[model samples]
Target: MNFQTSFPSLRKILVGIHDLGRKMAAGADLSHAFIMLDGSYGGKEIASSLVDEDPNSPKGMEQLKVRKPPRQISIIRHCVNTALLANSAELDLAMGPSRKASSLDGQSRFLPVFRSGSCSEIGPKTYMEDEHICIDNLTDHLGVGADFLSPGAFYGVFDGHGGKDAASFVCNNLLKFVIEDQHFPTSLEKALKSAFVMTDHAFADTRSLDRSSGTTALTALIFGRTMLIANAGDCRAVLGKRGKAIELSRDHKPNCNVEKLRIEELGGIVSDGYLNGQLSVARAIGDWHMKGPKGSTCPLSAEPELQKTTLTDEDEFLVMGCDGLWDVMSSQCAVTIVRRELMDHNDPERCSRELVREALKRNSCDNLTVIVVCFSSDPPPRIDVPKTRVRRSISLEGLHLLKGVLDSNG
Candidate 1:
């Protein structure tokens, strides 16, 4: 068959396979077949297969569906590998030789090591209500390379409201709860979810902690090449890739439609863009005063929405910061500043400091905390290309006409 002519179809098939792999990894029932391939590719006959099991043999298929833990992990890894390979192949075909050559140069290089830096400032706020944590080596405390566990990094930014107690408590105890969860390292999503709930409950149980105080949480956990982000409230996490800013977390504000619906459903009201006219954030760690009765759900939920994405060569760095920075600067603007700083200084710490400084210069009123996590060993190298300006030579007749017009005007 002519592979070049069938490339597009082949790419689509690979994408479908990738999607199926992800579904299987997520524990979706695979007994029922959903995909159908009945058409010909490059004049070659294609076979069709049913993904669903036979109606008469449901019990047999059910028995086969019980996968062992190791097998499950293997399937997920295989799916991820296949998807990456397909994507790389598609990219290669889409790019011409010149583009491919450029990719081989330093312009498309991937980092060999991961480094992180953080800075926090009590801006115009009366107190330092923002807290952050950076764990370079998560495995230092957890054993190295256990079954599903791999060495990774943990980073978070907690933006406090009402008081600093909630932020401080979450910053100190959240990671502990994540690592200690029964699903740690295996099912990352479960581990993170359990960790958030556990942290909320732990804070609520503390008699000394102020129940009226609360804080928004944004966390990024990098395990191997996979990233899992959990966010509650308005703090944000942005990823820098190829000079572009990609947001990894969503702000949980009271005005958001989804949040407003949930709040009203729970018999809570939003007034002037604040939850119950008191807190601007719809979700948080401690505001026990706004919660419903014990064992009952509340409009002000502590639950966080999670996001997952895999790291690639194109990914550069990640910026986690409180809303103070975002209030004055956009995600792309921040990425541009950080990229320029990294290029000039080759220092993530300095880059973060510059971000905080820029936010203060813009007149942010809240406390600010910024974390810059670089995927490279050193700050990303500056790619300096000379500028090309277009110039045109004037004809003799045109020049004479221009001179005549100038003389007339004078």
Candidate 2:
């Protein structure tokens, strides 16, 4: 029978059969075979196959022989179609399209899709002082109403200074505070601010953790189709959008004008590019040793500045990393490397691992932590845009005039 033209839906079944045959040829043992044929058609068999259940088969022995019955092919076709339909339904549920692509102002936009991966490395640092978190579904814990805010995701990278205690504490408890705040599930900005301040104060009150240790916090919270990013230190967040890198957080370096002014106004100094000649970041969490008396304001604040934008299809993924990665690679360079790796393997975890490896190759001396949150099921597709060219020519008359001026000067 010409199964190719007569039964187009059986293509996958045939391919599966071919694969099974290859496995059998490669020494796979089969234990049983069952064939059911219509008894109404004189009990004629439509198909039959032999299986060797013996475990002690000799080399090159024939274990399977498929027999084609003289008639009743219709029974075989019906069985195959039934099996194929079941498999097709499963495949549709597992690998079906989940995102809707739209357009906004001539640019492609996609609804937010939740898929994230993370990787961290000690690199050349004496200890792993960096930490990160990936909450795939915040609503699962927050129990927020859909009308107030749809289910969301969160990614954060913390870079510790002085020690790892602060980093560890914040990594484990920051999200908890954020969700438990009274304003949570409604006002994310207010909730995030209160969480950071509360976490900082809580750490300060703790006598077990190192009081002098601090960590830079950078977080990306995705609620529905909107993304809200907040940062309180040198840790960074960069968005990969249409093959370009867009920074979402500013590094809180003491040299920055705003940081410098804030530090000096709080009776602090930015001497030798360091805040108060000690810390390098002007903002952080759990640097209680550098802060003023409990109620008074301090130079090294834990308040994070927030940036919010609606996510679109053009936004590929977000890279949240410690300063260790940024120390050796520019944001665009990191994005380019990750984008290329994602295109090759479509694995965000692998892409983040590659970023850490690249930073190590460039001689970064700090602990590295990176989280990549993809906005779609797969990595962003590469688009090749044509470059425009311009040509300019000088007229003969204009050339003669130029030559006359040169000759007169000579």
**Which TM-score value belongs to model 2?**
0.67
Give the per-residue Cα lDDT of candidate 1 at 57.
79
lDDT of each: 0.77, 0.75
TM-score of each: 0.67, 0.67
Residue ranges of candidate 1 with Cα displaced over 4 Å = 1-112, 141-149, 381-410
Q: Give a tens-digit lDDT track for model 1, residues 71-140.
A: 2232332333455568767766887776768766654344335688999999987888888999877766
- Model 2, 106-142: lDDT tens digits are 3433457777788999987688788888987876645
Error of 2 at 189 (Å): 0.9
Model 1, residue 13: distance off in Å is 40
Error of 1 at 203 (Å): 0.5
